[model samples]
Target: MVDSESVKSSYPKSITTSAQDDRGSMEKKQSVQQRVDSFESGEVETVIDKNIEKSALKKMDLVISPIIGFLYLMAFLDRSNIGNASVAGMSDSLKLYNERFNVAISIFYVLYILVETPSVILVKYVRPSRMLAFISLAWSIVVLSSGFVSSYGGLIITRLILGLLEGCLFPALSLYLTTVYSREEQCQRLSYLFCASGLAGAFGGLFAYALEQVHVGNMAGWQWIYIVEGLISFIGVPLSLFLLPDNIEKSWFLNPQERQVARLRNEANLRYLGQQKFDWQEVRKSFKDPKIYVSAVSQFCADMVLYGFSSFLPTIVKDLGFTGLQSNYMTIPVYVSGVLAFLVVAYASDRTKIRSPFLISASLVSAVGYVILIASNSNAAKFTACFIVAIGCYIGPGMNLGWLNNNVAGHYKRATAIGIQQTIANSSGIIAGQIYQSKSAPRYILGHSFTLGCVLVGLIGYIVLLFSLRYANNKRDERCARGMFDPTLTGDYADDFRYFL
Candidate 1:
């Protein structure tokens, strides 16, 4: 379905600079040439109108964001619905006693964490539209199969396979968006993606509540949860294959002029669209970068709260003395609060071009919520604390992701960094699964206290990362002022490239 000829025809043969141009103009030309040399495609630059670029951007937002968001929603719903299933009697049906349930939950992350980096690296060769859609379809089948599982061992096998299939999605989606949106524009779009998880949390609750009422044949309510959610997720597979474009060149939604604008936008950020080859050096560079490690640490801390909270919210609520059905519907409001808070913060992040302040604030706010949950015994106070925790839970992880996306430049480097960051961050899922044990029900003092510590630690990591990025920017500025900066330097190493702090 990709228009291969359109890729060739989109750019003109070449653009030549006058030999008689001024010294500054020639230096600029030399800089551009150096950057072009670093890529394999050696594409020529093209002039584009700002108005046309804006129009193209708006079209991209309309066409691309919604589909990916919906797919993520399904992915999250399938994964976190286990919490709902556990509460709805899967625990009893499968004889998931003692640590069996926790093991099933933790097993998903094992393959998930291992496949992330490699799966992201595969996106370039397989293409986004095909890769994303195919994996989604595959996982949907696993989810459908999950409904038929009758034992603890069978449940664990499905979780493992589901983890492998779904692991390809998030990192791939994150990397794909970088190709579409400019650095300053990415956070808002990413907010839409992360917001899907919040929506999933909300929608999953509603679905669980409704499905619990069904008494068809002898099937448990938990089985229906997986079966229905799996069928719903199948809707996205066809939409992704037919509607999503591989890259700007293959974007059927844009006119020829608009395609040029898309390419120009990427070029403006020193991203040579579809030009870069897979480079081992870039992958190695990602590992060497201190920013990647710090960001990974922050992501880990944030995800500890995210995965733990999402997976255990129903249980936590049920322990608050509510019926199982009451617990499912009650968690809906908490997720809605998270989505609202994320939208407000994401808009401000894009407008001001800042990330750390909001990231730190979200972490601190969630810490306070955890404190309230640990210290207070009142049901109303504890429920309010859940809302407070939700407010910051979604924000921290999303902002951290956007922060990393903004700072990294080269395609391979960004891909590797995203994979690495996510791999490390998602390992927290293992810890999250174990922290909220059945023995620690009601108050869940251990889980609450542990998450509180994670929030504060994540806050400190953000502060350190902010200062580190600012310092890098300052160092680049100093080099530029001293005339020691290399005009030929590309990607994040370029003198003009500044980190988003």
Candidate 2:
């Protein structure tokens, strides 16, 4: 076993300790340095017992995953419940005629797209716990205020504010998960987060159906939908502030030994640590990286379907001859299908360590669903097509995110790429709102055909990305074999780094 002094001495004098060292004691520094040296020497498993690492990871799964998942559930609920409200009569109450309601829906994405990149960049500067918690609280207030809106103009303003606040969430949480979990562990954890959208859809439909029966004062059922869901999100604020740790080193739930193991796991996974200062070069690198653009195209196409489908599901169901309450209940099964499908796909992706195949498969599955929806006149067939469409809805976006997060390295670079990817992808929400306008309802041939085309486009993008990443990896391997690689290169640029294909 390596002793503490020798372990501390092994690190070069030029290698600076983390910023946390200033606040931590000498003993803490020694412990951390010892683990770092062990990782560098490829003896980390010997230094930190495997059981301890497993315990630490299991603990993170228990604490972090559920809290973030619940927050995302609320976020998705508030965002998509507008669809339920429209069906529940917010449109008539607020005099939303013709394309007015579509404008209200599209307006949210304008701010959402503008703020995603900046909000993710801020996650490095801000404590994630504080940032996420504060954003959740702020959006909850916006959601609550939405319940009281007396006019379309009032609703628009509330949606704008909600967009700005909620924009920070997905990217921030994605980045935060990267900080805590290894690359191999990421997809399953992210599925939990992404699956929350499906759960929110399920719960929102159930809630909307139940709330529609309420006769509280003069408040409509649509108003109660927003009020009740908004109030539930307030629970996340305290949960985040108290239970969520800023990073592995600062984790309140782990013991001293488990913290060391967690740090070692992060190092083994090639995750950048303690280097939170923003770098302009990394930001520039993200823009120049061809993979970001490819991933953006894929994400954009997937989100177009995601936003269009989720936002208008109730309307789609209602057009099938169901009453408002029946439409709300019918949406529950569709969302549950998405949640289950995503969980299975995510597990298989993680186990196989292959993302592109699953992503390609998802696009194909959803495309077939859209084809059925567009051609079928039978309501039963159309409803079955809804289930088929949902199977790949969460899988494509969830795996796309995990793929990007897996490939990118360095904190700021990854943050920038995620922001860029999400920004471009989320703009699809604008198109989603317009294409599914009231004029296109009943059959919604325009919307279904458009979404079908998106799925195919996204499929082609993923295939291109797969070949490009494979080519890049081969080039890197050739350079390493010839000893032409730079020893000083780190992060994803390192000669030893191989993209997960």
Candidate 3:
């Protein structure tokens, strides 16, 4: 996968100094050694690549993308299956009429929010492979147990634990992928993975349709949904533990020379981020950084639509005069559209090395979809709007994840930032779960209006962020022109580190 010859010819080779610069060369060697030591010790910042081969990257995509995507797919199905279950008699069986179903949905986010940041920070101590396997296994157990929940309290408890176990997964996955790919490369990679949520949506509908027809011993169709999905997740545990590589250095697929080049390229990113050593100061630095908050806020808005729509699409479709099974079948196209749009936008963004334009454009598309739903009574218009919203909401999160990954550097700072963003952003899940109440059924004007406002807020936030980043980069350039920029500066704070627009 690592095409050493092609990469060598495409980029300028590093010059080795002769006997004339023996003293300087010695110092340089020591510095490089220190960097390598730091990397091995888990004290160094992330290494970024200047460029990697298309074929080499494609090889990696084949290995990592599908695995990560499948993981997310399972997570989505487990998390959202309750929605489908509710319509299939879980509500009457569990007596979750009125707002009780909403409460059950909202309660998952309480523990989910609490554990997100800390779990991601914990990944720094534990290897990503081990952490991911453990989380997936634990959560699968919880989800399987949920199938047997006969009481409201039992369901609540299981949902809370499910949230806690799943809290670490997304942020951990994002951080793990960043270790291997450059910023520009991350968009498509993230899309490939995130597109799983869309796939999950489509597959979930099919699973719901298929499972609803089953008559298992002592279990209802709703219970079968949970049991089968949980079992599917359990199958992935062994694969992650045995087959997944933790980082490039340890990958079984790469040769020594490729590893050396990858290390060097990543070292440049380490230099940009400043220090590889763990520092409390780095975590505190993220607290003071405005970019992190902006990204988090933008994520918050985007996820409102994502969580709300994914969880409630079946209910909404059922309101359009379809039977329970028919509603599940109808949801396939919305998710399919979303997956297509996400892949296209991610590819374009990566090729152009830009995010804001696509993000803003997609958000506007979602906003218009919301407007259509709100303004129209026609069934065709509403269904078309569903597809538009699905397409639009799915694009922002992947781009924003890449945005933070590219701009934020340092181990603790980046980890903490990701955790914080996920925590704050996912809090929208609570709000989304509660927004589309049964009382507002059929039209759901209030729910549609609320999401419309959310996307607009996200659009405005990205626009401001784009200009502010440009201004910051300009100021850094001005300092460099005056010879006042720090030679030691690296990563995004460095005068030379350009933000991915």
Taken over the whole model, the C-alpha lDDT of each candidate is 0.83, 0.82, 0.78
lDDT of 1 by residue, 1-501 (tens): 322221221111223355575777666767555543322232334456757676788888899999999999899999888877887899999998889888998999999999999999889899898998899899999999999998888999999999998889999999998888767678888989888999888877778878877779988888999999999989888878999888775599999988877765666555423346888888898899888998999999999999878755776677677875676678888898998999899999988889999998899899989999899988788888889999999998998998998888788889999999999999999999898887888788998899889998899999998888889787865654444547466667666566788
Assess candidate 2 and give its TM-score to the true structure: 0.89
Give residue 269's lDDT in candidate 2 (0 to 100). Answer: 50
Best by lDDT: 1
TM-score of each: 0.89, 0.89, 0.89
Expressed as tens digits, the lDDT of each residue in 1-501 for candidate 2 is 523211111111112356654655875656555544443442223245767767788898999999999999899888888877887899999999888888888899889989999899899688898998899889988999899999999999998999888889999999999888767778999999878878887777778778777779999989998998889999999998889999886699999988987766655554343256788888888889889999999899999988878755776787787885676678888988898999998999888778999998888889888888899888888889889999999999899999999888888999999999999999998899888876666788998888888899899999998898889777765664444546576656765456777
Please give the RMSD to the true structure for each candidate, in Å: 5.8, 6.7, 5.6
Candidate 1 residue pairs in backbone clash = none
**Candidate 1 lDDT score at position 22:** 73
For model 3, name the residue pairs that clash: 43-276, 43-277, 44-276, 45-276, 47-266, 272-490, 272-491
TM-score leader = 1
